[model samples]
Target: MFIQIAIYGLLIALFPLAIVWASKDSNKYRKLIAVTLFLTFDLIIFGAFTRLTDSGLGCPDWPGCYGQANPFQAHNEIKAAEALMPTGPVTVMKAWIEMIHRYLATCVGVLITAQMIIAWWRRSSLRHSPWLATTLFVLVLIQGAFGKWTVTMKLQPIIVTIHLLLALTLLSLLVWAWMRESPPLVVSVQAWLRRLLPIVFLVLLAQIALGGWVSTNYAALACHDYPSCNGEVIPDLDFEHAYVLWRELGKTASGDYLPHSALVTIQWVHRSFAWIVFLSLGLTAFLCRKHEVLRANSNAIIAVLLMQFLSGVATVYFSWPLAIAVLHNAGAALLVLLLSMLNYRARAST
Candidate 1:
C-alpha cells in the first residue's frame, strides 16, 4: 500500500516536473519553486475544503483510503461503512475528497524533494543558499507527520490547528525563497516602517493561528452576527474551557462535551483579534504606499485584507458557506505569502 501510494504521488508530480522542464524561462530552478508554491497554495485551499466538508475522517486511516491506494479499490468497504452509519464520516464522495487531498500533498512532497536534489547539484551557481531548499524539504516531512497525526489522533483540535498553521508557515518560507530569485529592491524606507514590518508580520501570524483555532473547533457559526457576536456587543463567553489545548475535539480537558459558551469564546476571540491585524496591516500598507518600490505590494496587502475581512464576515452571516469558508482560508494564506515578500524586501532594502 505504501509503495503504491508513493508511485501514485510520483505520477502526479511528473505533470509539474514536465512543466518546469518545458518552460520558456531560462531559470528553471526559480520556475520550479514558483510552481511548487502555487500548488502548495492550492493544497491548502483543498485542505480547507476537506475540513469544511467534514471529510477529515472520510477514509478513517492514513495515506490510503481503507488501506488501499485509491477509493475505487476500497469502494465495497466504504459502501458498507456508509450503510452501517448513513450519516457517519465515511462516504464514497468524502473518501474521494480525502484521498485527492492526500494525492496533492504527496505531489508537493515529491516536488520539494526534487528541489532539494537540484539545489545541491547546482549550489555554486545559485544566488541563495542551498540550505533553504533543504530546510523546506525537512519542513514538508514534518508537515506530513502532522498530517498523519491529524487523522490518527481523531482530528484533535490542537493537532488539526497546528496542521493548518504549519501549512501557512511552509507557504511563508516558500515565498521568501522565491523572492530571493529576483533582484533586490533599491528603495529606502523610514526607520520606523522598517522595524514595524516584522512586528506586523508576527501579529498576522497570531491572527492566523486564532483563525485556525476557530475552524478546527467548528466555531465559525457560534456567532451569527458581524462586528458583534450572538447579537451582543460582548457576548458571555467561557474562556476557561475555551483554550484547553490538549483536549479532544468538542470536549474539555476532563473529556466532557464542550459547552456552547466555549465555542462562542473561540469565535469571539478570533473575530476581535482580527481587528488588531486589520488595523496593523492597514497602517503598514498606508506607510508602504509612499515608497514607489513597494506601492504595488502595499496595494495587494490592502486588497487582500479587505477581502479577508469581508469573507470572514460573510462566513458568519451566510452561515459558513463552503466557498466563503475556503476563501477565508485562502485569504489567510495570501496574507502570509504577501507579508513574507514584504519582510524580505524590507531586509533586502538599504
Candidate 2:
C-alpha cells in the first residue's frame, strides 16, 4: 500500500516536474518558483473544496485512510462505517475527496522538495536569497503537519482554522518567492505608501483568519440573508457560544447545541470585516496606480477584490452555491498573491 501511494504521489508530481524541465528559458529557478506557486494556489483551492464538502473527517484517521495508504485499500473499513451510519462522515465519495486532497498535497510537497534541492544546488548563482526557499520548505513541512492534526484532532475549529491560515501563509511566501526571482519593474511611490503596505498585508492576513474561522466553524449559512440576518439588522447574538474556542464544532463549551444567534454573530462579523478588507484593498490599489509597473497589478487587485465582494454577496443571496464559494476562496488567494507580488517588486526596485 505504501509503495502504491508513493507511485501515485510521484505521478501526481509529474506535471510540475515537466513544467520546470521543459521550459527553454535559462532561468530554471524562476520557472520552478512559478510552477510551485501555481501548484500551491491550486492546492489552496482544493483544500477549500475539501473543507466545504465536509470531507475533513472522511477518513477519520491521519496521514492515511483507515491505516492504509489509499482509499481503495481501506474499502472494507469505509464500507463498514458507511453501513453503520449511511449518512455520516465516512462515505465512499468523501473518502475519495479526502484522499485526492492528500494526493495533491503530497504532489505539492514533492515540488517544494525539488525547489529546495535546486536552491541549494545553485545558491551561489541565484540572485534572490535562497533563505526564502529554505523557509518555504520548512513551511510546507509545518503545513503538512497541521494538515494531519486537522484530521487527527477531529476537525477542531481552531486546528482547522490554523490549517487554513498556514496554507495562506504558504501562498504568500510562494508569491514572494516568485516575485524575488523575476521581479516586476517597479516605479517609485510615496514613502508613506511603502510604509503602509506592510500594515495592509497584516490587516489582510487578519481578515483571512476571520474568514477561515467563519468557514471552519460552518458559519457561512449562519445567516440566511444579506443586508439583514433573519430580517433584523443586529439579530440576537450569543457571543459566548460563538467565541468559545476550544469546543467541538456545532456545540458550545458546555456541550449544548450552539445557539443560532452565535452562528449569526460569527457570520455577521465576518461579513462586516469584508468591508474593511475591501476598503483597504481599494486604497492600496489607488495608491499603487501612480506607478506604471504597478498600474496593471493594481488593476488586477481591484478586479479580484470586486469579484470577491460579489462572491461574498452572492454566496448569501444565491443560497451559498458551491462553485461561487470556491471561487470566492480562489479570489482571496489571488488577492494575496497580487499584493505580495506588488510589495516584493516595490522593495526590489527600490
Candidate 3:
C-alpha cells in the first residue's frame, strides 16, 4: 500500500518535472527548485482551505483515505461516516479535498527528493551545497509526521496549529533553498536594521503562530468588529484558558466544552499582535526599500505586507471569505519568503 501511494506521488511529481525539463532553461535544478517552491506555496494555501472547510478529518486517516490510496476506494466508508453525522467533518466532498491536499503534498515530497539527488550529483559543478535540499527533505519528513498526528490526535488545537506552522516553515525552507541556487542579490543595510532583521523575522513567525492558533480554535469570528472586538478594546478574555496549548478541539484541558471567553482571548491576542507585526515589518521594509540595491526586495516585502493587512481586514469584514482567507495565508508565506531573501542578501553583502 505504501509503495503504491509513493508511486502516486511520483507520477504526480513527474508532470511538473517533465514541463521543467522541456523548458529552454539550461539550469534544470534551478527550475526544479522554483517549481518546488511554487508547489509548496500552493500546498500551504490548499492546507488553509482544507482547514477552513473543516475538512481536516475528511479522510479520518493519515496519508490515505481510510487506508485506501484514493477517495474512490474509500467511498463507502466515507458515506457511512457522513451518514452517521451529516454535518460532521467527514464527507465525500471533503474526503476528496483532503485527499487532493495530501496528494499535492506527496508530490512536493517527491520533487524535493529529486532535488536532493540532483543537487548531490551535481555538487562539483554547482556553487551551493546539496545539504540545503537534504535539510528540506528532513524537515518535510518531520512535517509528514505532524500531518499524521494532526489526524490521529483528532485535531487537538496545539497539534493543528503546529501542523499549520510546520507548513509555513516548510515553505520558508524551500525559499531558502531556492535562494541558494541563484546568484546572490547582495545588498547592504544600516547596522541597527542589520541587527534587527532576525528579530523581525522571529516576530513575524510568532504572529503567524498566533494566527494559526486563532484559526485552529475557530476564533476568527470571536469578535465581529474591526477596531473594536466584542464592543471593547479589551473585551472580556480568558488568557489562562486560551493559552492552554494542549487541548482537544472545542474542549478544555479537562475535556469540558471550551468557553467563549477562551476563544475571545485567542482572537483578541491575534488581532492585537497584528499591529506590532504591521509596525515592525513596515519599518523594516520602508528602511530597506530606500536603498537602490534592496529596492526590489523591499517592494516585494511591502506589497505582501499590504496584502496581508488588507486581507486580514477583509477576512473580518467579509466574515472570512474563502478566497481572502486563503490569500491571507499566501500573503504570510510570501512575507516569509521575501523577508528571508532580504536577510540573505544583507548577510551576503556583509
Q: Write the per-residue lDDT of candidate 1 for residues 267-324, one digit (tens) a residue.
A: 9999999999999999998889898989989999999999999999898889999999
Model 3's alpha-carbon lDDT is: 0.88
Question: lDDT of all the models against the reference?
Answer: 0.92, 0.86, 0.88
**How do the residues 1-350 of candidate 3 rate in per-residue lDDT, one tens digit apiece?**
56777888899999999989998988888899999999988888899899999999999988788899888999999999999999999999999999888888899999989999998998999888888889988988988899889999988889988888888778777877777778766466778877788899999999999999999999999988887996899999897789898888989889899999998899899989999999999899898877788888888888888888899999999999999998998898888888887777776665
Which residue ranges in model 1 land beyond 4 Å of their true spot?
Answer: none
- Arrange candidates by TM-score, descending: 1, 3, 2
TM-score of each: 0.98, 0.96, 0.96
> Which candidate would rank higher by TM-score, 2 or 3?
3
Better of 1 and 2 by TM-score: 1
Q: Model 2: which ten-residue window has the lowest total lDDT?
A: 180-189
Tens-digit lDDT string for candidate 2 (3-103): 66667878989987887789897888888878888888998999899888888899998778999988888999999999999988899999999989988
Using lDDT as the measure, which candidate wins?
1
Residue-pair clashes per candidate, as listed? Answer: 0, 0, 0
